[model samples]
Target: MDTYLMNERPSYTAYRERFLAAVQRHQGRVSHYEHPLKGRDGETLYTDVAEIGNPDATKWLIIISGTHGVEGYYGSMCQTLYLQGLDLHSLDADTGLLFIHLINPWGTSWLRRVNEDNVDLNRNFIDFTRPLQHNDEYDNIASVFNREAIEPEQRRINEQLWHDRAAEIGETSLRSQITAGQHQDPEGIFYAGQFATWSNQTLRTIFANLPKSCKQAICMDLHTGAGDFGHPMLMAITDHDYPGLEAAKKLFGPWLYTVHTAMGNTSDTGVSASVDGYTSQMLINAMHDKDFMQLVIECGTYSPSMLEHSLRFEHLHYLEGNDPGGHQEPGHSLKSALLEHFFPHDQQWREIAWVRTRQIFDQALVYLRDGQTHY
Candidate 1:
């Protein structure tokens, strides 16, 4: 383990232990969804659900972490912190708090952004009965991501391809197409699997089990990356406007960002707006009969140029059959850089991320309990 990580970041095993302990200490009702795979430490992997307060409550606040795997570090830390600081008895009898910890356990455990099957879990929630969204341009740059090695020749070819594509379609468009999510190539970056992932299915099952009497809920899916470094952006992302979106606006006022995602849409929020099958939209669809709000808290970290290089290098590292679990050679250096980008070693960044998340949670609690209709 890196010295900084030892002092700052906790491994997946350590995180899970702390979260489970915190949940128990808070007297939370817990359930575990076990993943078939094991963690890098050979420990069992699970998506644990812990509910504090009345599970049968009419109003609930759901906080989900680990949608992007490695990004779950920030989410998991915040969730654990919230539980430790929570006064369980202060919560209203009609209100409940549900914590979905590490939904993408495989990704978190392996220190990769994608799941065990290399699928981006965010893009795996689409309705499979319909045709999958295609990114035709992904094929043009597919070779860049499909490289088996990170040699000088591979880097040169990759750079030339990116340069050429940027010249043709402009750098911004090229970036959007690359990350907009695609299903054409299983090996490509941002590959949306042909079928729903285990994490996707697990999330569906979790929502399906929601108390029938629950009429209103606010769900915050925690994530990191994009936006300005150390700053957390609260957003409501959906394909169409809904009552929950209006409610979010009323509650947060100028603090909230509304992103309507669709084909040909562009967003300045730094998240990909052209993609479909987001976890946010999935929650909206699953709770169509109830008044529900799907929110995302994305904390900014590093520069786009650095992020791009890190992602590419890590992808190549994975493709070359490097064991991310090992702390040897280039794999250690690669994983360390990737981890730092998503979850920075900077103390201030960690503090700001948690503080912002706590603020949002606090506001949601007040709204749920006091029935505040506006900020």
Candidate 2:
């Protein structure tokens, strides 16, 4: 099978088929689960999760892709390439591998950040008994969307309003409001649904059905569109002082940057609310005997302002149903920009990405094999 590189950006259908095919090639050595969904294209889109090695292995590495729909193109491609190139015979007897690909198939096919219902899967995983939370800050900015036509003057006013809100509430708080997840507005950006989405329910099933034989667990959830362009930033999601954080730092060495809960340069406040609704948190919460480590490999694709503008345009296009072409024209441009930012089309970038990914995976494998809790 041909291996895909960072420079290669396959169409949604082509990538999905290639990924499925790669899993099929390893059928004897790996088990597969398909979480299928009906996409806007009127086709059955599927999220494929594959497992390798013995079910009873004491150490397991779980790598997931596509929590943010469009980001999956790079994440899924990376995993598929890794799996195709991996040599199963070299793995230790006590270590296992789990690759969850395309968590949001709807977003992927439609080139959206959210699912079909416009629910951001990252923010959908909150505990229900505590009463759901809504970002009222967005309500203040709701006028940005009430317009039939957004003139250049209106856009300037909206930008000022957003900046003023950030200044008033603080950038971190504003970021939390925009990203912490909310159930109130289905059409709004970063909307967390009032209930479990199809992906949410399907992920729960996957977690519940996880093999009983595994012991320790490490997860790397792939993402993009945050940080420096083309730089892959590894962010640890657990508490800053967690044993896993230290171990990960040791394992990945100086190349891996740690984003702690309180001390890191990166924003960590809104993440807990974001992941609380996803499968990773549920899996970590359920595992009593295993030491769980979770990392989010977020590759930078564009400037923050660029990303915000693109996302804003995407939401506007979705809400107004204003498309010059048959499909969402602005959304497509944003998607293209996002893809280029994370997975550059340049051969030099592809080479560097390939090398970095290989090193990370190798280090992870070594850590699992040694059964070293410290690493």
Candidate 3:
């Protein structure tokens, strides 16, 4: 396990240093929101906000990472690389850039997909006052997902149950139910929190404190570990078609795919269409007065068919094993294949992801540079 992760993401301190240094090169200032907990190596953690250009800029481009925690390994690299490559002098007066690094610092530090409370940060952005959203299909599959122990026999049972359900409802529908998220069982995988989490509150505060005059925004929440390996898919993901969908379509032309999420919905993008409380939706709802394009750059890692079982094993290890206390020691030992599921070690994979992501950023910056964007 130790050897496999030797080439994994940089340490949190290293990541922070690299990002901060890159921002300094541009003479940018970072508003650091320090996390309450320390990292696996007993390192300080923070979600640093690097805002570039005019604070009162009407056009804003914001890039965020670490929504799923462990996936931040990849997301952080992208953020650092992008910042280092950005030419701050090119920005117009009305458009600026914001990089929100490591939204769920605790999750990244401990190498877990969920936050410190086992909540999927992406799924924790919903309103707690309203009745929680339900997935009847998730309720039916509770026996499989909510298992306390994942023994060989238990693994077999879970597999057979998955096959049965896949045959009954079709594989795509089954996948939708599994990833749509639920709040009923805290121990279960993809569990949304029962209330607002610290990270959730922090992000909301970041938005609320932003310059109120800003009208148009492009908020991208980056992710990995889905779809074809090494492919970075550009998607506009939301619970419904928001106002900026057309703007996104026009901006990216054939490079973009629009995903309208709903219960029992279908998509080839490998993003969950049935999931609610996505960061994108929350940003849109919170700043409804402005034209906001809530986007996602989902760089594909390993296939979900292989990753689901691997992640479940890790989940059980996290649930049953001793906590790593925000230290570098992960709850579950890392395997090469599992590591690739989030951070592929292949140089080609890294290059492709960077090249594609940079291309998209180039387009986005141009849109911000010019008042209008065209293919």
Query: Which number leads on TM-score?
Result: 1
**lDDT (10s digit) by residue, model 3, range 181-290:** 99888888889889999899999989997767688888888888877888899988877676688888888888798888887787887888888889888988887888
Backbone clash total, candidate 2 = 5
Q: Write the per-residue lDDT of candidate 1 for residues 168-211, one digit (tens) a residue.
A: 98887888877888899887789989998899999999999977
For residue 91, model 1's alpha carbon misses the true position, in angstroms, by 1.0
What stretches of model 1 exceed 4 Å from their correct place?
A: 1-7, 306-308, 373-375
Candidate 1 — worst ten consecutive residues by lDDT sum? 1-10
lDDT (10s digit) by residue, model 2, range 45-126 = 7777777777688788888777888778777777778778878788788888788888887787777778877888877766
Q: Which residue pairs clash within candidate 1?
A: none
Q: Of the candidates numbered 1 and 3, which has the greater lDDT value?
A: 1
lDDT of 3 at 10: 55
